[model samples]
Target: MSSSSQGEVVYTPQREARSAFPMAAILLVLGVGVLLPMALARGLTTNSELKVVALELCLLGTLAVLLQPFWGLVLVVGLLYVRPEESIAALAGMRFTLLVSLVALASVLAHLFLSREKLVRTPFNVMLLGFAATAILSTVPNWNMAEAVLEISKLVILVLLVLNLVRTPQRYRAFVTTLLVFTAYLALYSIYLYFTGGAMQQGELARSQATGIFSDPNDLAATVAAGLALALVRARNARGLMRLVYLLLAGSQVWAVVLTYSRSGLLSLLLVICGFLICSMRRKAISTVLAVGLGILLFVVAPSRMTDFDRSEASANQRFWLWSDGLQQLYGRPLTGIGYGQFPEINGGWTAHNSFVLCFTELGLPGYFFWMGCLYYCFKRRVPKATPEEESEEEKRDLVGARLALSGFLFSGFWLSRTYVPVLYLLMCLPVAAQIAARGRPGPQQVKGAEWLRDCGRIGLISLGSILLIQLMTDFLK
Candidate 1:
């Protein structure tokens, strides 16, 4: 099956045959080599039996990935978001995260090579590469070379897989669906933890959190905030049962964010709501009512700690000091700044707690330019107006959801050093992916020399404005 430029579904026998043949071959080989052996095993010890099961599952998963690669991408996303290994003791030693990521990367590369597919071209591609280059250059004089390399490699692999795999509207929907489902699961699990006395204690309050990447309540809150935006947008675009499911997911996400008691998270959530109210024309009255109700509920449920913005608040003060340190570091090394992963080492075991600050301070002005340029283009680019018939309303909603997700993440990043997180990179990839998918192929070069220069100038202005805002806030606190 295939889709036309007008979004009509069509059956293509040759394409189906081409796709099915490889999948059938893979299944046959897997059954013969792995599944049959597992089935024939007799009198195996319990541990050995578990090992066999793991191996069988891994082989099956690999086969599926080789056939469609999107499943592999979803698996990697599941690892990053749900992180079952951290909660499931039996799986702790499996290193499934690394295993699955490597498999996905390899499968994606193989598929692209065999299909003679070019990497999807976008302006963000060059900016991402430029950022990676700056990271390498920054590491040249740093002692944390290994850490820098590992982080940069992850970023590169993630970007490549997203750019290459998410080439169709179907794949884009799958990606969004995967994120929403996992986020809902995580939110529900966190809520259960909160009521079960398993929540993590921060000061006098017990805050809900998840395992692995979301272990920090602030991080979890940021994630839920983004998920909330996605759920709302999805619900708007969906029908009947699926719409109900998305609405429930959105509600759970909002509750989960509140449970974290993160000021940044709450602020991010508010921003998402406001963004909807401003951007959504069809349901303005309904959205306004919902927003007001949510605001009231937030005021009632919010912890005093979250509501407090006094300069004497320990966490708030610490963030101000960290911002100051970041600015000082940037000033001290205006050209090269500190190296990647060195912020904690030089700042007494505290991260910058701000993505922009971390990027500017760690990789200096060049890295900042690349990073900001990437973000700027993410919001700047749009689906071509000529393809309006091809770009369905559902696709447009997905684009808006992606933008909202990024906005939520970015707003939360103001109080958390999530510059290197996979979620950030993934959110950055979605808009570009959507634009590419809408065009039905890689679009023409987006940025010219003049456009590049103009972007740089705009980024510079944003940097200056942000610096001024930070300085004023720090001074006011002082």
Candidate 2:
């Protein structure tokens, strides 16, 4: 058969073999886990409170991770080991999107249902539930369903994709490489928008604003900032051809970031760069001077369009209206707030833009605070594990570089909730999980029942969250 006729992409014999097992496992798991909850809960009347039930399900699903870190690790590592996406696109075929989405869904479902695998707990699922909880009890129609499906689809894909692709440091590097390539596209796209999209506005507070595909300069900048963190980590540790490639790509991504007139993104990027420089443990004095110099340069060279962002007039004004209206609704029913995903119903789907505020509008104070607490738990709780051969020169360089990369991500996440970005999700989770796996366990060990109780607690929270979604799904007005 002609090579072209056979299709340009073909996998090696081994790749074809490994892909089948995980794909099937994912399907079987989701069928039993998520859909079953919907079926059993079908009789519940959809109402503002139903959204809360859905939120409970998300929480339960997420907490289910605590019961099975090893399983979570398996899904994550398995994803890396096989990397079906790059090997043979045909394996996923046209259903690739659904395929990955289902993997994400299934992983969570598996975590929740696999009572035997208490070690399957994962922070990713915890966050997924908490994020979903924000939309519980919303008056908005189908808000619970959309957010639930989207949350499951994304988190599932994230867990499956990263874990499958990141089996080793080398595999982790490949993931970063793919990410850098994507960043390059973002850079080029930003260039396209800078020159053509919006007429360059003058004397605006957001003067240097650079909007690309996102239609918002800030969002575009934020995305690139994230890519830069990964690129920097890879560039620092790479060698030979790969090293040179990573450096060039990282540099390109940084340059692209400068073009986006996002003050906040630049601020976040600056913090990441400086954080890495400090974490690198280079001579403190020199690092200080260098960081200062770089900061000055950034300030001087910030985009001509950034003037618009300075005032925050557009952003602040919109935020005020949303907040005031949201407060009025939330205060009336302070405990439940508006239903999960109900923020749109409040003001026609205009986001609070800021994620923290977004939670408030959708979930009110109770749900918002609970969600934040979970996020805090995930982000703050991390300890890098020991690697073998740290005594060697190359290994030391690697150790330092990996930490720097982690620093970049940690610093950047301060500016945006990266819990969802597929690349960012893996970049952060892979290393953190590797650290835990290397330790031979995740966190301090406790008795089996204690762990079960912990998961049970999460299940209770999520089960209540499920009811929240159900309420939203059933809200009589809608």
Q: Which candidate wins on lDDT? A: 1
Tens digits of per-residue lDDT, candidate 2, 45-115, equal 54435343533443343333333333333333333323433344333332333433454455544443442
- Per-prediction TM-score to the true structure, in the order listed: 0.88, 0.58
Each model's lDDT: 0.77, 0.48
**lDDT (C-alpha) at residue 97 in model 2:** 38
Query: Could you give me the TM-score of model 2 versus the true structure?
Result: 0.58
In candidate 1, what are the lDDT values of residues 1-478, reduced to their tens digit?
1222221111111123355557658776877687757654731544566655665666677667767777888888887888767776666667665677677888766665665555565667788888888887798887767777777878778887777777778777888888888888789989999999889997688999888868798899998888888888888888999999888888899889989988898989888877776566578787778778877776677787777768787777888899898998988998897988889989889998888888899999889888887887778753333555656887887788889999998999988898888889988887777766654633245456775687778878987788778778777774
Supply candidate 2's per-residue lDDT for 144: 59
lDDT of model 2 at residue 460? Answer: 47
Global CA lDDT of candidate 2, please?
0.48
